[model samples]
Target chain A: MSTVLEMLSTPLFQRALLAALVVGISAPVVGTFLVQRRLSLLGDGIGHVALTGVALGWLVGAATGAARADAYAIPGAVLASIAGAVVIEAVRARGRTSGDLALALLFYGGIAGGVVLIGLAGGTNANLMSYLFGSLATVSSADLVATLVMSGVILAVGVGLRSALFAVSQDEEFARSTGLPVTVLNIAVAVVAALTVTVSMRVVGLLLVSALMIVPVAASQLVARSFRQTMTIAMVIGGLACVGGLLVTFTVDLAPGALIVVIAIAIYAGTAALRPLWHRAARPASTSEEARADATDDPATHRAR
Target chain B: MQLADPGSDPDPLHLHGVSVAVAGTTLLEDVSLRVHPGEAVALLGANGSGKSTLIRAALGQVPVVSGDAKLYDVSTRHHAARVAWPRIGYVPQRLSAASGVPATVLEVVLTGLLGRNRWWLRRADREQALAALEELGVADLAHRPFGILSGGQAQRVVIARALVRRPDLLILDEPLAGVDLLTQFSFAALLGRLHAEGRTIVVVLHELGPFAELLDRAVVLRAGRVIHDGDLPRDHAHPHGAHDHLHVEHALPSEPPTQRSLP
Candidate 1:
């Protein structure tokens, strides 16, 4: 505990910890919307797209060598994210039912493109592994700032457009009749989600990105009773996993991003295992007056627990 | 299904000389119908009767070739503030409340307010949302996550969400199509109450016996044209009243909404 406190005082440790916390909190919050929309795999879809963005970013900067990587990182990522989002949107517009297929195609295709680009640049899979799983120890203060700013914007969008977003998700035609500007808003949401995925890629790596984006949220929804409460709980769980991952990574010598995701999945498994007990214990006796309240309020017992 | 005789009269939403051809087949031909504001209407026909096609064209949610549905006082040529959108609140047949929709019952209802006001939902928004929920008898479900609600609850929430803005026109496509008898009756009661408030409701009615008492007027679509528009049987039980209004030449086929049945 003292060493953990000691680590917190260090600049490098503080930066990694903050980055993890920020990413952790933001992913699950956004994940709730994605999960509700049945687009949990879409995060994986965008994660692969971000890989292509990174390759493209690397390719563009490599003309002058690797020295310029930091300078071109965000712009390249942003441009690629926009392109990837447009492709997904086009497929959806064309009435493609399997968003997962589209995502898989995009993911594998982008990865191939990335691998080819790396080969052309004389880079190897070993060099790219850092981008795959992430390097939390290498997080600079600027990365922390970027994560904080992006997370703040994403969270703000979640709060302000909460109802409008929900209206679209629930009954899109009704939302249209209510004048929701569904097309524009839908596009904007995709772009924002793409952006969030792009930023998150740096923390969890392109491969494990969806776990961060989805699992924490899925776990929290299992526990939370309300929509708002679910989002809050997801954030808490995500933040905890990130902090715990960072602490573990520092203590033992494991990859920080992978450990973070590992911790998140463990949390999910833990919650699932404990749900039967919590669910049963939470149930009120049928003969009691409290049973009526338990029927609605205690949702754990509401489903087939 | 009704067909336009292709002569004499063209209803307000008339499809005069209009033949929509897609993939080398004609979908609708010379369809015409008049629908006025504050008129409780019905579009009745069997499946594939082009009822949905007509509704889409009338609302201008889709483009009609060689024909137009003109809202009174608005030119059909220019884009105007999402015309026919704010004027009508529509509820489609299916709504996905699948896992992960981040809205509550009250939040969904609040969306109805987005059209008339730009400000965030203040106290008045909450009050109106509550009132709409109360009108539907599901005010207690206001905070429930929308996706978690039962089918009956979802139906009532959709109705409440539609009525939140006090819309001039309400359009429901197959509102009672799949619901059970009990829920259907409750939905029928909601329609009656809305009609009492002087709001126009357009419901696509396939099963007429259940809703005959509450229907103010109906515009039957056969193929894509109005086959009947005039007094329908206001009371199914009696059917033999002196002033039944069913005999009128221009009386639409819907029952008079204002009249009460034999007690």
Candidate 2:
């Protein structure tokens, strides 16, 4: 308890906490739509591609003799991730092959390319481990600012395009027929999702970032009755998991990213187990009561002369 | 193949010399259809007889290989940028609830209004959505989770979603394909009401069934060619007058909308 309080007062802890909270809120906001669209693996695909960008950033910095090469990593990763998402969209539009096949190619090819690039850049195992497992405590103040601004923009965009996004996610063909700019909306969502994955990689690591994007939203879906409720609840669950994992990391020797994922999975499991009991508790009353209400409310039952 | 008949019908929907082929297989060949104002036309055919493909081509969902597909006298390719969607309402085929995201009936209906230029839904938007539900007699279901509704109720909610836009032309693809018999009666009744209100409708069906009384014309396809197009022939395949009890005229307060002439 004393150590947690002490850590909370430090600037390093403050920066990491800000990054975690921003990621916690923003990841699931975009993630709910991704899960609804059945593209939950998109985060993992983008994260793997971001690794190539991160290693490339390091190489460019080393060649230029920059003081801090890591500072260029986030932009490089974001660019690569967005490009990967666009390529996936292009492949889907081609109609030449199955969408899943294209995504699988990107998913495996990205990681393999990233590994080779990291090796060619002369990166040590420690540097690779930081991006893989995430060194949350090492987040600089600049990273904190970037995470805040990026997450804020993501949240704003999500809220602004909520209806169009929901429409496209539910039925793309129908949305297009209604003039909702289905293609543009889909590309916008993909770009935002890529941004979320890139920023979240610093806190949850590239390998486990998808868990943060999908797990909390999945848990929320078990209980939430509406889309709005599901989005709000998923964000809250992610935020809670982040805070809980951080506090635990302060007290014990554990990887924060792994702990956060474990906490999210625990929440999903608990929600799933308790869902049946909750349904029974909240079950609607008897058929007789429902029929009575329908008799009173249904105009079709009362014929007009 | 040649395009549509060179007639000056000025219909709401007109397809001229349309052909759609996938790979080496011909789905529709040399097909032309025109849906005039205040007309309810049913496209009928057996499975794989090009019933779905023809409507898909008319809606510009599938590319027309040879001819032109126009809506409100505007080419479908340029329709979106020309502010033409507000005049059209489309309800797709029924989808399973398991394959959907959880949303309230109201939220699903509100998606109809999303094609407008507004960024946020206003109070008037909510009221408009409720009024549409009320028109369909499903206002009580506004707050219910859409995934929990039965097939009949879900269909009505989807119709309400389309109707909220107040479209002059409504298109439904297999609206009663999966619902119970009782639900079909309600759908027939709703179509009757829409017809009396003078809204143009184009529906796709496997058979006339309960919709026999509401159709102005029947256009049947056999292997992508229009084999029959004229008045509906009375048949003994299904019982008629199943929806006679639900034929009450709706009490709409507003006068019939004044439709615009073809540009």
Candidate 3:
């Protein structure tokens, strides 16, 4: 308890916890749409692409003799991630390149470009390790501010345009038929997902950022009865995982990002194991008519089993 | 604002020699169809005959290779000449309402009210969505996750989603493809009520089983060309067999020669 209190007293720990909380809450916001659209790995692709941007930022800063070259990394990551997201969406939309091939291109191109740029900038691969694995100790005040602002924007769009985004993600053809700006809304989802990757990169790092986005949502779906519930519960689970993981790191010698993702996975496993019991407990509340309807009319349920 | 009189209104759906080709193969060839106000038209054909593609082309979902398609005199080809989508409700083919994320039946129905230039749904929107569900007899399932419902229930919810907007023209594709006979009858009766209320409907069907009595006109397509266009083709086998058979074979001959193309 004293150790936790002491950890909280330090400004570094405070900034890290704040960033984690912001990333935790916002990653799942954009993630709900991505998971719905079946583009759950899009954040990972954007993360790889952002690495190039981070390296480019470092190169430019070092060339200009800036006092802190790493400060420019976030802006660079944001631009590169957005660019990567748009390009990926365009490629997928055109249908010329297969979806997996496009993602492969993004994953390879992004990491390669980052490595090459970092070498050109006269920095060893070691300098990139912190960004890859995440170093909460190095999180600065400016990083926290950027994380907060970007997360705020993401939460607004994710929640405010829930209906439109939900329609588009659930059925693109029907959404387009309704004369919703399908293309614009699709791009908006991709852009928001990209922003989420960059926002979370400082806390969970690039490689594992998608875990923060996807695992919490997956955990929530095991018991959530509706999309609204899935989103709300996922946010709660994500925030808890982040805070819990950070606190554990203060007591144990472990990587915060890895610990956070492990906790989320544990929650998912727990949910899966308990889902049948949960369903059984809720089953008796239904009337006899609903029970008979399920037995005879609901082929989908039987097929699922 | 235009008057509410139906007689003076433009055709709800109009296609002028619209041809759509995906890849090297043509899906719809020079298809011209006009659905007048309050008319229930059905597009009928065998699989790969392009009934779905024709409707998709008319709605400007697929880019037309030549000619034009319009909704209420506004061209679908141009983005600036936007169609008043609020006046048209569309239900796609038997796509599973289930996605990676779970959605309540009410939430799915509420999406029908979206894209009408509104960012936020009002409390009234929830009531309106519930009313649509209630009309479809699936009001009890409004709070249930859409992914878990039976096919028939899901179909009703989807129809409710389409009807929530009170669209003048309802376009449904293969609404009864995979449902039980009882559900099909109920669907037919529901559509009959909507038709009696004077809504224009354009539906795509594999066979006009229960909907035969509801549809006023049938446009038959074969190999991407309109082979027959006029009154519903009489089923010689079951001339008076309305709602008697659970399944009805296509009235037209199955294997019409490929050379017989309409000019």
Candidate 4:
């Protein structure tokens, strides 16, 4: 308890905690739509693609002899992931390349590109390891600011266009018929997903970012009765796991990103185990009410008029 | 029922020599269909006969290779023409309303009222969605996950989503495919009421069961071509059969061969 209180007063811990919380809130916002579209691994693909962007920034900085080449990493990642997302969405929409094939191309090509580019920039693999596995203690104030702004934008788009996105993700044909601009919305989802991958890369690292995006939502879905409820509960779970994981790291020697993901998975496993019991407890009242309603009004007779 | 002259009011849906080809294979060849307001028409054919493709082309979902599809005289191919999308309600073929994520019946129904410019939904939207569920006799199930519902229940919820907007034109693809007999009868009655209220309806059906009395015309397709486009064919196999007998024989000998040719 003393250590946690002391760590809270330190600037480094505060920055890391703030970044984690922002990522916690934003990752699942776009993740909900991705899950609905059955593109759960899209974040993982985008994360791999963002690695190439990070390497490109490093290479460009080395080429120009900039004092701090690492400063350009986040911007490069934002651009590259967005580009990768658009290309993937186009390929999927055109039906030229199969969906899984496109994702595989992204996953393999992105990591290879990053490794090759980092080598060209004269950077050791050790420097890239921090991004691959996440180094939360190294999160600078500028990185924190970028995380806040990007997450703010993601939340605005994710929540503001919830219904339209839901419509398109749920039923593309029906959404298109309603003139919801299905193509534009599809592209938006991909772009937002890309942004989420990059924003979370610094906190949870590129490899484990998808875990944060997906596990919390999966955990919440076990008990949630509606889409809105699921999103809300998932966001709460994500936030808790992130803050809790970061706090735990203060007391122990552990990687915050891995710890956060482990905690999230634990929550999901616990929820899955408890689900049958939860349903068993809640089912009787609702079923009996449904039975009583069924007795009073026959569905056929009510619909006949 | 009075049949309005085609030259007077613009049709709800008009396809002019529309030909759709997907991946080098033609699905609809010079298929021209006009659905007038208040007319209930059925697009009937056996499996893989282009009945679904033709309607998809009319709705601008499938790109037409050589012709035009218009909604209220505005070409659907031209986005600048401003198609009145809000006035048209479409229920696609038997796709599960359930998605990868669980959505409530009300959430799915509320999506019907969403448009490109509309982002947030109001409290009134929820009420409207619930009212649609109420009309479908599934108001009590509005909060239930749509994925867990039975096929018939899910079908009713989907139909309710389509009807929530009170569209002037309703296009449904294979609405009764997996539905139970009881739900089908009730659906037919509901469609009859909607038709009586003067809304145009285009339904794709494999067989005309309870909807036989409701449909004004039947356009039958065979091998991506319109083989019959006139009155609903009488079931010659069962002259004294029940009114609800399934009529699956769409290729009637009475249809003129001249109507079968592509322009």
Highest lDDT against the true fold, candidate = 3
True contacts kept of each: 0.37, 0.34, 0.61, 0.60
Output the lDDT of residue B62, model 3: 82
User: What is candidate 3's lDDT per residue for A91-163, written digit by digit as tens?
Assistant: 7777754777878988999999999998998787887888887877778888788889999989989998888
* Cα lDDT for residue A120, candidate 1: 64
* Model 2 segments more than 4 A misplaced: A93-97, A284-288, A291-305, B1-10, B234-263
Comparing 2 and 4 by TM-score, which wins?
A: 4
Candidate ranking (TM-score, best to worst): 3, 4, 2, 1
Segments of candidate 3 deviating more than 4 angstroms: A285-305, B1-3, B236-263
On TM-score, the candidate that comes out on top is 3
Model 1 Cα lDDT, one tens digit per residue, A39-145 = 78777777777766776667777766767554455566667776787678667655557765877788788778877876665566665677777877887777777
**After superposition, which runs of candidate 1 have C-alpha atoms over 4 Å from their true positions?**
A64-66, A97-102, A280-305, B1-30, B60-66, B70-80, B101-103, B116-120, B223-263
For candidate 2, lDDT tens digit of each residue in B172-236?
98887655555577788988888777778899886576788889998888898888788885661
Q: Tens digits of per-residue lDDT for model 1 on B120-202?
A: 45677989999999888788878766766655567777878787877656778777654545567778887887766656677
Each candidate's clash count: 10, 3, 0, 0
Better of 3 and 4 by lDDT: 3
Q: After superposition, how far is residue A188 of candidate 1 from its true place, in Å?
A: 1.9
Question: What i-RMS does each candidate reach, in Å?
Answer: 9.1, 10.4, 8.9, 10.7
